[model samples]
Target: MDGCALLPVNSPGHLPSHHEVTRFHCHSDSEDEYVIIELEDLENLSVAPDKRSSFEPGSNSAEATAQELCRAFRKYWLQTDSAVQLSDCLSSSKQRSVRKEEIPRELESSLNLAEEIKIISKLRGSSGWSPPRSQIIFNIHPSVKRDAVVAAQNFTCVGCGTPIESKYIRRLRYCDYLGKYFCDCCHSYAQSSIPARILSKWDFKKYYVCNFSKHLLDSIWQHPIFNVSCINKTLYTKSKEMDRVREAQEQLFHLKKLLKTCRFAESVLKEFEQVPSHLTEELHLFSLDDLVKIKRGQLLPLLKDILKSSTSHVDGCELCQAKGFICEFCQSADLLFPYQTAKCKRCPECKTCFHKACFKYGGCPKCLRISARRTLSETPSLVPQ
Candidate 1:
């Protein structure tokens, strides 16, 4: 009678059997409302505390009154349990929702709980619950889609073989030559952490220079030209070697322009024009007479040796001992000396010292010859007929 106390059959505490009818209060709060429930009606109700018997409330039988009371208790318990469970679920959902910030900006607006759960499942295995397929709307990037396809085949990072997941796919970077996808961490290390010696061996065309800017390309040509032997020994890939050679040729072309500005160099270049436009072909075809004249003539001192100076002296003359000859006009020691065997030239007219390489293309930067600019017909061809 008080606060959900169950009445047992044949107990002394219950209403005496002589009393055919008893008044039962459904709830403690309402003292005015009382239902007439009989002892037999209580006994007829099922044993389960929450289950309500089918006995109808409107029926004229004593069991009807008992059924009404049982139904009220059952409804109260069900509502209480549901409210508690829902509260717990909401708290858990809030915790899981915190990860939404990590999603890419492009996908943020369209993301939903169902799609999030699906992505989480893919990354960290299933959580034993799956939402309907129609609810999941994926609008991922092309790169992510490609990664997903690759992950389906390999199930791991292409570079390190770590298990591929949705999170990793979002941050992945690709290597074209390697033809594989790498994790973000590993890709970053490859770009900045690798040693220069090892990095030099990588294919410049395929891997390194693929994303080069115009400034970077020009810088390659502007930098001091490396020896062919050095480049050949260092670069293992054919593409890289070709890139080095091409850059070196471009640098040489620029150097030729500087040479043409001088009257003496202009004359030497005019002599060179008869051989061919390409320097490599002309070098191969040069006769012994040409070499003899180039070595001994005043023109030898004008050709700048662009090589860097070495600290130690090797076998040869003062120009060779200096490692590289300097150009007086440029006032920089960075000029290249092509002939290692040649000697330095001191101009008798100006008493200025010049490298053979510098004098060959152009006389001293200060001494311009009016005759050096004579018409091509007036200048005799250095090539033997």
Candidate 2:
């Protein structure tokens, strides 16, 4: 009378007398003996074969239904007997098992069952549920694939010598010269700029020499004249003493070719011719005797000076006129004395000329200024207001 029993709700006379019953045993806290009763398999009997197949042990829907049934049974049982003490039967069974390896297998099976239940719950709807097409659930984390790639490759950046994160591995580049992978920072420097000055000569030769010609050409185009003033002047003088003129001459020949290729040779030669002999005594290697024949080593400094002075003079000459054969200062060609009308006025003192507009603006070289001032003081009425 204290035990529970399950009986079929409706039994017909035509039905077989022998029906299957599943028995379960439970003991009260005060009693040592166990009580058992025949229980009808309500789920097997009420559910159709096709419907029951969906809740089989291997199916996700089955796992979900089983969990729901367990919860409902526990709730109903607790309602019936408030004094009944409930414990986790599954955990107790696991603790009682002696096989260590079997315990891990059981835990893994439980985890799989829980995962299937979760997946089934997500896929379930009012229209009824269907098994997910993919058996393995894909992780939604954005970095999952990237992390897998990094782990598989075990990639480390050559530049920083650090393990590269999976997300940043795509940003790495390969350098043929160094024969290694480089991070963004080092790869950009290698591709876009010259090797750092801190790099040793051997390293420069090894890692940078392959692209030196390109870098040199780019530098020359950007800045036509190479400035060597930063170098020790004594080095040049010492080379001359050592009779390394052949090397210097060879370099000069190559330099001339470069200037000519860049369409600067003619202008550079003309500028060199105008330079004073005294000022170039230190750079005597670039003698004016043959402007066409000079070493680039000697011409380098002169070219820098020309570019600098030309830029300054052009900027300073506010009244500079268009280049022509007419006199810049007088702006007159004496038809009566055609022979005396020189193409340009060469100031004796400064060896410079002033355009007519420049003369009007009081921009005449110092040598011509003294004579003009004296003449102006002599004939005040002739001076324009």
Candidate 3:
């Protein structure tokens, strides 16, 4: 109750008294009500008697500089800390960006996906719900092909040109991900599941990877670079768990859109601090980290928990509830959101949500209208102009 007191009562579910709401508003509003509180705090600071002077000519240079910096910080915070745009607040932020190694200048750019990520991570963050999965190009090297085998054979280390002393004595380590050879110091016999093999062939076998490739993978483990819908649509049919997780992710995506747009849902967003951020920020994209979680059978449960909390917030917020969809098919009084998996089914073509039972009878009205419009446009006029 005390923590909830910080925010205004947009729609406190069962609160019966205006008195409590008034008290909370008074407590929070008290700061604003006392406009000179900050000034008074400065005046009342407990300065040592010896250091204090009754009539000081002016504040010292350090004090002036500190006041200026404080003002600037305050201005910046006020400008950015409102109901910010979804893009501005929800953009993908990775903890580390792989700095290109001088020895292997093309290490980060060796694969198309790697290069694309470098560009994206460097540029101003994208504003879309999820990056287009179709645009992600995976460069998986064929191991057995003659040309591929021949090209991979290098007399020197791929990292630093450290030549092999003897073929049998000190063999070079082959990195499956980069399809290159490295010396002992550069390789360290590190092994990890390759993203290329995972995305293209759905293979999860561990293989030897160079230190550079391992670090690179680790850095982008949580970056949304894979688009299973575009890359391997058949995987969903093959893996029921993946499909389920995808559906849950879609629901969370819809929920995030609502929570982000509602001006009264700021505290609700703060609740997401302890959870995986990718679930809310990117809709259709999956990170290597997410894939790992799915492999471990842990992603769905986590997503479900997130979904429960997010939906609860959207339902409780009056501003978010105002935007809820009324079932056009049955004309039901009940308000529906696309995230309500039990109640609503979203139209694949037009992306409209309706009660599942109602949809079974009426079909998608928007899709039918679109089809009719298309047919009318395609048909030629019988009479000449």
Candidate 4:
């Protein structure tokens, strides 16, 4: 019999192999009097295949035992003659006979026929067996278009290009305009990152469209900033524009607060004064116009010097130092100073010099006032690194 016909929770009593058969039972009866049945787990059986088949051909006692058991089943169920030839031996009736034939040899002499029948019933009940349903039902969404989302994301994930499998492919939900099939991970990224933009602009009603647009935009826009090939200059320009907007907004906010406190503006000035001499000299040219008034010129230079000093003091690159370049870092080549003929500004410890681009990218060779004060106050230091 096909293994698929044998369900997990319930199985037919017919042994799937020539292996030992333990228990049997009728599950469901049809109009034709043939009842579907299932066999119990074979592990509990005491019959030995080698011993049963090993019996001498003329062992009439074994055959007689089987016939007597057949008579019992016929009297109880089949209602047919016990003396008939074993014409239908291929049917499940053989299993009932198999059970009865083993009892006298396998059971202890103390156990009676009633006890053996009881044992068979108990084993039959305990063995997991059931009838196959005539009709199987699945409640999956008929028009759901399961792979719709995955196909929306594309065969490969939009967020991370993982190739989708067939099972998940059909199950994936599609977003038509996004033109991609979203795996769970990319789907979640689309949901969180994309929907957030939508939530900010509109409510949930247009979420699908907004989310799809957002996902599409991300797919189109996401690319590495600086690659040897395909540098994505358009994205780079937009990113810089965004950075300018953010920086301008922050400076406006900071300046507003600074305007409220003379001490704070004075601190900004003091920080500007602390810029190293070489950088100061290059920047001092802008301070020549005293005609603007000492305070106005001072403030402008102070702002310029602060930004320049911050960039210079913070950025360093390990890569440049390793390459024996003093005035530039390769990844941050934009930070390289325009005046290569000019003096070099090098970090004290790393002995590395950096251009404006390198300086901005290098993080910080020296701590700035905001973070320095924060670290010194919050963390305990053993001494110095």
Candidate 5:
């Protein structure tokens, strides 16, 4: 029930006038005039990256203060049911008389009872509720003593070598039919004691199942029962890994079976044969002597023709030109501007129509660039794949 209170920084109206005046004075500091910029209108305050520091300090102390305030408020807002159950346990313990030496024992019991009560109370408080039985035997069977049951069962379940969790017995009809000191749920579900001979059979069964699951590479090792290991954790890990290997083996076996059924050997070979073994690349080329090189008259006409041909063939924006790239931000493309694709990607400048990809070039353009494609249908040719 013990808790603390905190006054919210934003809830200044609830505070006395003196406290409010103090807060105002702290914020309205004149000595540190440069640090204190008056945001008369909070809306006018710029959240731009450059202007942020003048407002919020962004410090650890500020963060811690905010967290502490939240915790204090949460304490006031939330109510837990344990407060009532704790009171009940203490009251019950007070009514019981005990010897001086037994005081410690009594206190321990009370603490445990309080814990159980708290659990139940919390469960009931939740929207969907379920309850466990009121009585729980700590270490011994309800009807049998620890040693007697262990002796009869040979310190292990006759049905399975898995040892019982605890010697504590809970009294119930037909419990003796099963070997003594079985886990409560197991005892109830099985409805009889497991005999020593039956336990040996179970051991054999477990060994076979465990080995099979491993050898076959089954995913069954994830089960909770399989998780319980007789050996140390290190060995248990090795055991599970073995299971995974077995699962892989099983998968391979199934794949083989599928392959056999599908007659993969015959079809697989045929498919391999169909793949091309070699590629041919040959093109006619003119001799260097025959290649016409240079006069401006011929060059200009050819250049113009080439540009016209490129414009008709290329698909790009009229504004940017299909020069081989386009600006991402502006998304401009044309014959003069670059056409953009993965390997040929470029960014076109806004005003100058400069391709950002062409960083080697200095500021001024040597010649004007032109558009390539006016429309999608006007796209000339698909590049060879």
Candidate 6:
């Protein structure tokens, strides 16, 4: 999992789902009316903006035509609403019966030997997931209190809605993330460090998770989805160790900026490319896997290895070494760089580098120059006003 490549720099946009289209019905609060509308139906109702038919053809005045068009639309809506209601009722009942009979008992039979029978079906009719899949998951909902809620579910597989009554209930395993029971085929004792548990409680304990949840967690293992600063600032405040790792991540992030443009450091850059972008570029962003590694004290050593490799390349290569900053404040003979956190510190305002001791006395020379120019330019305005 450590070798997992970072997600594409340009994340995929939400694609229009080609799979399913539920009958769109808008119920008016006051009118108490609804009619099934498909995506295609809206296209037929809409007139082209450039076309004259958008307005009533007979009426010459724009205002009068618009009023007539509105009245006609209202009439059309009411007619369609009433007409579809009667026709849809008879077919709906037959569809419900058909769906019940179509429930596949293979789900339970696949898990264990149960003398395959179509005894259990979802109380509600569901064909499949109809909505477009989400790209990112920001929040993992906490585990439900199973002792209170699981009893009410009446021993059912949450994955396929298979009823697990009597001895069959023993075949089901509980998923920690969703707090629901599923057959061994769905749960399979697959363990994942629950995101909610880690973020909220800082608990690294892996729990039995369903296949869907396990796969979902694994997919974003390398993506920088978590922002520790914004999502949980207290994580740093409470855990001193996490704060240290964060500081190292910040140092690596700043150092990467230099090596990115240096052609001579291509060898180191190519090797370091295996490191997740979050570690090198974004300071705040972290993946769930990163948090687990941080707690286990493996991340800092890995980062140090990255720092050493890049630093050694920069020190030796003349092209990369020439990019270092000299102390402007002290006019020091030695070269300074942002990554030299021990000897050099960047000015917060202008980001000009200086010797650690020199920065305190001289402040930022670039900032002072900018301030002087700003004051001189404002002098004329200040004199008059």
TM-score of each: 0.18, 0.18, 0.52, 0.17, 0.17, 0.54
Put down candidate 4 lDDT per residue, 1-385, tens digits, no spaces.
Answer: 1111111222235434544332444322122222222233322232233233222223332333333323332343331221232234224344453332211212343445455545544553433221111110101112323343333223344333455666656634343223334444324333322222211221112222223233333332221111100111122233333223223223333333333244324444356444222222221111111212222333334445565533333234333223333443444433332122133445544545565444543354443444778888998878888
Q: Between the candidate structures 1 and 6, which one is better when assessed by lDDT?
A: 6
| Deviating ranges (above 4 Å) for candidate 1 | 1-145, 148-153, 166-168, 189-303, 306-385
Location of the lowest summed lDDT over 10 successive residues in candidate 4: 132-141
lDDT of 5 by residue, 1-385 (tens): 1111111112222323221111100011122111111112121121222332221223232233223322332232112221233234233323331212200111222234445435433543432111111110111113434444343333333222343434332321123322133332223232211111111111111111111112111211111111111101122234343333223222222222323333323443232222111100001111111111111122223323433333343333232122233333345653223222222322234234344454333333322232322454578669875
lDDT of 6 by residue, 45-157 (tens): 22222332111222232232222333332333222221233234323423422222222311321332222221321332222211111112223433444332333343455
Q: For candidate 1, report its TM-score.
A: 0.18
Give the local distance difference test score of model 5.
0.25
Compared with the true structure, all predictions reach lDDT values of: 0.32, 0.31, 0.51, 0.32, 0.25, 0.53
Q: Give one digit per residue, the lDDT tens place, for model 3 in 22-99.
A: 110000112111100011112113222232322122324224322432333233211222123323311211111122
Backbone clash tally (model 4): 32
Kindly give the stretch of ten consecutive residues in candidate 3 with the minimal lDDT sum.
20-29
Winner of 3 and 5 under lDDT: 3
- Highest TM-score scorer: 6
The lowest-lDDT stretch of 10 consecutive residues in candidate 1 is 130-139
Selected candidate, larger TM-score, 2 vs 3: 3
What's the ranking of the predictions by lDDT, best on top? 6, 3, 1, 4, 2, 5
- The alpha-carbon lDDT assigned to residue 204 of candidate 5 equals 12
lDDT (Cα, 0-100) at 170 in candidate 4 = 60
Q: Ten residues in a row with the worst lDDT in model 5?
A: 278-287
